[model samples]
Target: MWIIFGILTLIMTLLNLYMYNAGKNYHIFMVLSLFLMALTLCDQYQMIASWSLAGDWSAIADVAPTLSMILWIFVIGSFVVNVIPLLLSYRKNR
Candidate 1:
């Protein structure tokens, strides 16, 4: 459920922050966040598709499109935050 997703996301975010602050590679956690977000979106899409199959128009209507948009934003934001430092560090080391 969303509660589980929230907890996992929170843990990942904390790990990412710690790694970032320590100047360690945080790309792995960013990748994990992207994977998690994709999985959740796919699951949500499947659920919505099932609702349509069941002729439950109301269920589809109830799904806020903004929710998925928000997820996309967060995943993309994580990539931006993690990747810049990773690239910068790589270049500096080289």
Candidate 2:
């Protein structure tokens, strides 16, 4: 199930990147895809950690908490970047 989520997230990210490169208006989608990917990474990390601590390495779990944390940081940064422009434009119009 988690693997499926990861794969979907990866696909979304790639699609967003392609759209971005193609000069399409998909900044919001890019940000959202990144956020989802970050969440999936965090979930995968937790699953891996639990399995490792229980000494159950054969369960085929994915880990890497540090990487997940980094991704979360990126997500937050990207969210801010995505929102600030909209806020500025709104304020300017008002």
Best by TM-score: 1
Q: Please give, for residues 17-64, the per-residue lDDT of candidate 1 as tens digits.
A: 678779887877867765666666676677778899999987677675
TM-score between model 2 and native: 0.46
TM-score of 1: 0.67
| Model 2, span 25-89: residue lDDT tens | 65666566666766766776687777888998667333354555766675575556445544655
| Span of ten consecutive residues with least summed lDDT in model 1 | 1-10
Error of 1 at 88 (Å): 4.4
The C-alpha RMSD of each candidate to the native structure, in angstroms, is: 2.6, 5.8
Instruction: Say which candidate scores most in lDDT.
Output: 1
| Clashes per candidate, residues 3 or more apart or on different chains | 0, 0
Candidate 2: where are CA atoms >4 Å away? 52-94
lDDT of all predictions: 0.69, 0.62
Candidate 1 segments whose C-alpha is farther than 4 A from its true place: 87-94
